[model samples]
Target chain A: GIQVEQSPPDLILQEGANSTLRCNFSDSVNNLQWFHQNPWGQLINLFYIPSGTKQNGRLSATTVATERYSLLYISSSQTTDSGVYFCAVPKDGGSQGNLIFGKGTKLSVKP
Target chain B: SQTIHQWPATLVQPVGSPLSLECTVEGTSNPNLYWYRQAAGRGLQLLFYSVGIGQISSEVPQNLSASRPQDRQFILSSKKLLLSDSGFYLCAWRTGTITNYGYTFGSGTRLTVV
Candidate 1:
């Protein structure tokens, strides 16, 4: 089983500030995804980056597969972004769909 | 496009009562279904996954069980509930293939056992 650990278990920032979150995995992974869990308990897909980088609106993600780590970037954060951000990878590499999730980084954006 | 639906946005059950949560996927067939739980202030924990009808794999040993009676239906059931079972339960699904597809989660069911 692969272990996924996220950094800065808790984070707080002003509405206009920017921040970076990191996720480290113990083994190589073929699939990786980022999600934002809102206060209503909905998991919203943020990105699916097994390797390389992707950007969606004010948020972006970069996964360095060789290093077995991923980075999530938020620029000019909004108060609505307050929630838990989780990164998950396939429990077994390749076709296995079982995902191993990190504890997550709780972000609070104050207006 | 594919969509996942979960029932009973919220529930409150007695400790010894039974439990049943339903999840259904539409616009797709033979999709991989999963059940996950998140305790208060905790991360998502994989409880069960199914690749097809009548085929389920449990990731953790607990009082919970899952069943897939149809190609797009996944059910989570408990013969008797426990106070520790209180949490947010989510249902997710992805394409049934070996591609790099991401999962789509339902709105989740908030269950509180007393």
Candidate 2:
């Protein structure tokens, strides 16, 4: 079993502010993903980055697989961004889709 | 484009009552299906995963069970619900490929056992 930890368990930011969330895993992973659980409890996939950096509009993610850490950046945060951001690393194997999820970074974007 | 549909956005069941949650995926074949429970202050815990019909792998020992009667249909059931079973339950799906495509999660069902 691998351990995944997320930093800044809670965060409160003003709208238009920028923020960074970090995720650290105990072991090497072949599958790494970022998810946003909205206020309505819907889990939306943000990124699937096992390694390297990727940007999706105002949101970006960077995963340093060698260091077993990943960083998620949100620019110009908005009230709609207030929710739980989760980092998941699934077990690496053929036909194995068990994702080990972090407790998550609870972000509160105040308007 | 794949989509996952989970039923009953919210539920309030009596303790010791039976429980059944259903999840179905569209636009994919033989996709991997999973059931996860997110408790308060606790992260999402993998409860079950199935690679194919009637093939299920339990991740944790709990009062719940899962069944994959069809390739794209997954069901989570419990004979006797407990107060501890109250939480947000999510159903997700992933392709069989080992890389590239990301997983898709459903809207989730919030279960409250009274």
TM-scores vs. true structure, each candidate = 0.96, 0.96
Worst 10 residues of 1 chain B by lDDT: B94-103
In the range B2-111, model 2's lDDT, one tens digit per residue, is: 67899989999999999999999998899988999999885999999998999999988999999998889999999999999999999999754677757788988999
DockQ of each: 0.82, 0.84
Position B20, candidate 1: lDDT: 99
Error of 1 at A5 (Å): 0.7
DockQ of 1: 0.82
Per-residue CA lDDT of model 1 for A16-67, tens digit only, reads 9999999999998888899999877889888889899999999999999999
Per-residue lDDT over A14-110 for candidate 2, one digit per residue giving the tens place of the 0 to 100 score: 9999999999999988879999998888888899998999999999999999999999999999999999999999765424868989999999999
- Angstrom error of the Cα, residue B17, model 1: value is 0.8
Estimate the overall C-alpha local distance difference test score of candidate 2. 0.91
Q: How many Å off is the CA of B40 in candidate 2?
A: 1.0
Residue-level error in angstroms, candidate 2, position B73: 0.8
